[model samples]
Target: MTPSQNFFSDIHSIISQARQNAVRSVNFERVVMYWKIGQRIFEEEQNGEQRAEYGSFLIKTLAEALEPEFGTGFSARQLERFRQFYRTFPIASALRTEFSWTHYKLMLSIDNEDKRAFYEAESIHNLWNARELERQINSQLYERLLLSNDKKAVLAVAKKERLPEKAEHIIKDPMVLEFLGLKQESNYYEQDLESAIISHLQEFLLELGNGFAFVARQKRIHLDGDDFFIDLVFYNRLLQCFVLIEIKTHKLTHQDMGQLQMYVNYYDRVEKADFEKPTIGILLCADKNNTVVKFSLPEDNKQIIASKYELYLPSEKQLLEELEREINKEKD
Candidate 1:
């Protein structure tokens, strides 16, 4: 590059850094202010003998007095959220500056403490914006993952201190693909799902979980005189392995599991580097029978998984039913 171009690029890079730094500073200050506000409100609430009565109208009175001077940001509802925020995160040091107040508010709505903490840590680790954090929570990402793991395991992921060591650690069954914009009645092919994922690859990766990067589509593997094509290939930095996904628009079958197993074996034997982990193969299909999946793979299988894919989030009732079923199955 020319010296002039180099000079311009340097200036632009510095400007970008400066802008991001300024935004971070502003967000940090904003969060600190909210924490202080919450602290003051709590202290005030406990100051008098009739604390219960004082607390009843404390927020409304504060909102009325503050909103007139400070603006609509201090609405009663928002003040209550601020109060709840302080109650939930009693320690000021626990609040992360990378997230905006919006992120905290969304997390505070969660009734489960473990779930809330997990989401908070994950938001920071993944650098998810408020919208992304909200989307993940609303999609029941925690509950879905819990279906595959125990409480300890679920919390460990949010901590980001533990990385995925096995296939189950990285795989989420009944993966939600609502972002693909496919209708329920539409007769879509596996290729259609593949194309949609490619188009919305960023959102797809978020749904896939952390540390996934698109590698290839229809990755070709030559066997003797024939060529075989794998549907989608992704490299997960966290797992240090390649994720080979095979899209099936029908219920998962043992044949599908066998085919994916062959692909995984081929990649592990031929494609993986000496330092990399074994390639993980996923067969994502429209439906999955737990019995079928259990019987299809070896008792100690970890390199391959068969999971269901959903074009939409299941309704709350449907999700509850599914969860109960999973619980019962575990008991059995």
Candidate 2:
């Protein structure tokens, strides 16, 4: 590539940066304005405690006045959202300027305070757009983490207050891969799914969870003149470990677990340096039976995981049901 000092390229880069910066400035102002509107409404509500109906009336009157002068952005519903936004983020100085009002609006739809705050912080850290934020929420990223970690601690990790220590803390079960666009049919080969994952590597990394950097696809290994391959290998910087992942197009079995364990052992013995954490192995399969997996690995095993993978994103209702089942099972 030519040096950026080349005339046309330099002009292009300068104009692009200027436009991007301008958009960010406008977005920051818009977000702050909404925050202030919420603050104003909150203050008014606080002062009118005597009138039970004042809150509703205040919003209606404000919307009526503002919508005509401004636009639909000030609709009563939108104003109420602004009010809730202020309530959620009481500290204006702490608001994340990296996100636009659109991102905050989507985040506000999450009713849980910790979950909302976690998503907000993660978006700023990950540089996710509104769509990506919505996707992570819809996919229950928080809930998935909550499965392997304490609620408070998981929220802390999401907020960057603390880092994950183990592979379990960052891995997602039944990983969502709707971006691959593969049909839900059972005829696809393992290589096909591996190829799709490689093709959509960025999306795959996002679904794989945080701090994951892809190492290789179908990483080859040889032992005693025989060859073997691992479908995917990722390194999690947060955990400081090699995550060796084997993809199975069908349900996972003991043989699969054994194979992955061997790969994990290989990496721990040969690939990783002395200062790095022990390698972790994951069997990413279409299906997993908990009883079989439990019996397959040693009772105290900490380095092997068998997680199911999904070809499509589940609907909200379906995700809720699955989450409830997981919660109940965990309780048991």
Candidate 3:
């Protein structure tokens, strides 16, 4: 490239970065302004002996006086949100500058404290903007992770208190694929699903969880005279292992488990480095019987996991019901 072209490129990059920094500064200032407003409103409410009635009256009157001058940002509904925001995150020092006001607004709707904290930490860690964070929350990412893992461990990993030590802690079951834009009613082959995932690889990785870097597609391994292909391969830095995923258009069976196990064994013995952890094999199937999965693998097995994949996102009620059923089945 000519020196002139290089110079222009450098200047463009500088301007772009500067604009981004300016926007971030403005966004953080707005977050701080809202927090201060909420703090003042909360303090005023505490001063009144009848907190609930007085607080409602205070916000109503305050909005009436302020909205006309400052625009709709000071509306009664917004003021109430501000009040709730301050109450939700009481410590000013805990507020992360990386998070915009919109991020907090979305988080405020979450009733569970642990769930809220998980989203907060994940957003900061992943640099997720408002839209992505909203998508994950709506998709019920936290509840999905909680399905087969302990709550404290899940929170600990999400909050970066510790890295994930187990595949189940990070690999979500019944993976949501609404972003893939596939018709739920239509039948699809394994290759079609694989192609869709490749096309929407960024969203796929986000759905796959943290630290996953794509390695290969249709990875081929030669076993003696025959050749077999693995559907997808990913390396997860957080788990420090290779995650081999085999897509199945049908319900999972013992044969499917054995196939994944063989691929996992090959990866562990041949591909895995001495310092790296064991490879984890996931059977991403249309349906899976937990009882069949349980008996298919050895009692002490932790490397093989069967996860059901959905072409579309499931409602929170449906996910909760599925979790409840699984819990009861385990109890049996």
C-alpha root-mean-square deviation, each candidate: 1.9, 2.3, 1.3
Off by over 4 Å in 3: none
**Local distance difference test scores for all models:** 0.87, 0.86, 0.93
Candidate 2: list runs displaced more than 4 Å: 1-8, 327-332
Q: Give per-residue CA lDDT, model 3, range 84-185, as digits (tens).
A: 999999999999888988899999999999889999988988889899999999888998998999889998998899989889999998899999898988
- Which digits, one per residue and each the tens of the lDDT, describe model 2 over residues 222-290? 989999988889998889899998888888899999999999999998899999999999888999888
lDDT accuracy of residue 111 in candidate 2 = 88
**By descending TM-score, how would the candidates be arranged?**
3, 1, 2
Candidate 3 lDDT score at position 232 = 100
Clashing pairs in 2: none
Which candidate leads the pack in TM-score? 3
Candidates sorted on lDDT, descending: 3, 1, 2
TM-score of 2: 0.93
Query: What TM-score does structure 3 among the candidates reach?
Result: 0.98
If scored against the real structure, what TM-score would every candidate get? 0.94, 0.93, 0.98
Residue pairs in candidate 1 whose N, alpha carbon or C atoms collide under 3 angstroms = none
